[model samples]
Target: MREAEEFVDITLLFGEGHVKCHKVIFMILAGRSDYFHRMFLTSMVESALNEVPIEEISASTGVLLVDYLYTGRIKLTTRNAQDLLVASEMLLLGALKQNIEEFLCEQIESSNCISLLNFARM
Candidate 1:
């Protein structure tokens, strides 16, 4: 369904249920920043997952993204980049891995052997 239809369905699904369910969901819609943030992050993650539908990604990469989404901080480095590729590769998350692979491949073509090598090794 389209976004508008999905939202309407959700509204109806909740509103047609227990009063408390409607109340709680309404409160979420009205005032929960955390809820919104979590949903926003989930949408981004899902889009990435769709780009490469794989079993899973590296635990470290998932943790890293989750941390960033929730806390807005990550100790990003030249290396976390490579690690993402490795994790994506292992998880067989094709769409997710494809994006990372594309980036690493470009780096390799440009002589960034370290990152490319790490990705290849993974």
Candidate 2:
């Protein structure tokens, strides 16, 4: 779906980057995320816009989120996991946020535990 980019109805803009995706994907994600439900299902301004500006997360992270919604898979790395977590929180995706938190916890070591704690606090 990402490769084909067919029947895509929404373009999420993030800073200088953007992600093109289908509204059906958002409709499915609406069941799992209240934020998506409100933004795409209700009579909100975003529901009527073809291009929605997303200031919360980077376009890279947005791609991951959309891919996860489409494929139910994501390759979470230490570099991108933090941003994904923040994005999931903002999107009200509890399961995704928990998955990221668990992944981060599994990666914690004495060397990085304090830093991880501080990051979590933020």
Candidate 3:
């Protein structure tokens, strides 16, 4: 297991909700996503404060996104895959986005194709 304080230098606040992640690594985060890279490398407020507010995503999705940055893996299910896909796109995680897109495509059927298509278009 990894030590929280040893590697963690940033915190992500999810909306006005109760989720706050304090175990994010700058290198892994910035390396995996251009959004994170720019946020940390530039003179953005997030770079100075080492914190970011993500209002458009749910707390659960935010946790999954951070976990992917650290572990290179994420638990994607029908229940949360759409939210994860959106988060992955916002984070600029192309590989993860592709994986989720493939997963959704595989799950398509007459029963859910319309809903899935709407999600894909978003």
Candidate 4:
């Protein structure tokens, strides 16, 4: 493996915010998401600059996304699951999306079923 500084080649800009990560982390994302694969491999500007701008996602959610990308773990709860779902969908993270969906499904019950349905539709 390359040294940390040498491996760190990409800057992900998220809604006027940004994060730095190793190219290896991005390789993991590319393997997982078609969106990221295309972004890194096919998008001329991003491929050349090694930078990606994610304007629609919040920095906190972006952090979560990166954490999941690197660590393969995410903290999902009722408070943040919805936003994470949106982020995962936007990022084309199929595994994370399915995880969130399954979590939400498990949370469904008599009281929150309708609310969960509405949220899912949105």
Candidate 5:
């Protein structure tokens, strides 16, 4: 489905990037994420829009999210783990959030512990 991009009904827009996906897929993902549940299942303004601006998530993160929604898999790296954690938190994706948390935990070192904590507090 990711490759096909067929029957796409909505566009998630980042600053200079966008991802096209089917509302049906989002409807299915709603069960896993309350953020998606509310947006797709409720009478929210975004539910009716063809293009939804997502200012909080980066374009690369959005693409990874869509990939996960379709494939049930993701690759976590220090470069993307923190951003993924923030996105997962906002999306109410507990499992994904936990996965990112675990990955970040494994990456923590004495030198970066304080900085990581500060970023988390922010």
Candidate 6:
């Protein structure tokens, strides 16, 4: 079989900054799909989701992710999950995007919240 076409001008987020590259196309592990040509962006997103590990997933992130993946929107309730903030930051999930650094900093400032602090550390 002939090799699949590689991507160019690929830009992926690296923390708060973005990384520009021309050789990361193959790094995107797209799965079996017949709609590739029609839904290129969706295909890539699914591939990216697959790259995330469940072990790294937080308590209610699955729920948040489900909502976003299905509706393109989500409202995070503090009751939904707290530890999820870290996972959200790591996954770049919108549930805990804004002021995450501040929250993480606050958690780290106190030693009693060591578990939460540890969670954010990862």
Best of the candidates, TM-score? 2
Candidate 6 per-residue lDDT over residues 2-101, each given as its tens digit: 1221343443333333333333332321122122222345545534432322445542565454334334565555443464555555455553455454
User: Tell me, what's the RMSD of every candidate?
Assistant: 14.2, 1.2, 2.5, 2.8, 1.4, 13.5
Task: Tell me which of candidates 1 and 4 scores higher on TM-score.
Answer: 4
Cα deviation of 43, candidate 2, in Å: 1.5
- Write candidate 4's Cα lDDT for 8-114 as tens digits: 77778888777778777767888987888988778557766767788888778887788788889999988889889998888899889999999999999999999
For model 2, how does the per-residue alpha-carbon lDDT over 1-122 read when each residue is reduced to its tens digit?
65688788788887678888887777788887899899888899999898999877887888888788877889999999999998999989899899999999999999999989999889
* lDDT value, candidate 5, whole model: 0.87
Clashes of each: 5, 0, 0, 0, 0, 0
Model 4 / residue 98 / CA error / Å:
0.9
In the range 32-86, model 1's lDDT, one tens digit per residue, is 2343334334555532221222234444565554333334355545667666656
Please provide TM-scores, in order, for all candidate models, with all chains considered together.
0.34, 0.92, 0.86, 0.83, 0.91, 0.34
Off-target runs (Cα >4 Å) in candidate 3 are: 1-9, 17-24
Task: Count clashing residue pairs in model 5.
Answer: 0
Clashes of 6: 0
Q: Estimate the overall C-alpha local distance difference test score of candidate 3.
A: 0.78
Return the lDDT, model 6, position 52: 26
Residue 63 local lDDT, model 1? 55
Pick out the ten consecutive residues of candidate 3 with the lowest summed lDDT.
15-24
Off by over 4 Å in 1: 1-60, 65-77, 109-111, 118-122
- As a TM-score, model 5 comes out at 0.91
Q: Which stretches of candidate 6 lie over 4 Å from their true place?
A: 1-52, 94-96, 99-122
lDDT score of residue 36 within candidate 5: 83
The better candidate by TM-score, 2 or 3, is 2
Checking candidate 1 for backbone clashes, the offending pairs are 51-95, 52-94, 52-95, 52-96, 54-93
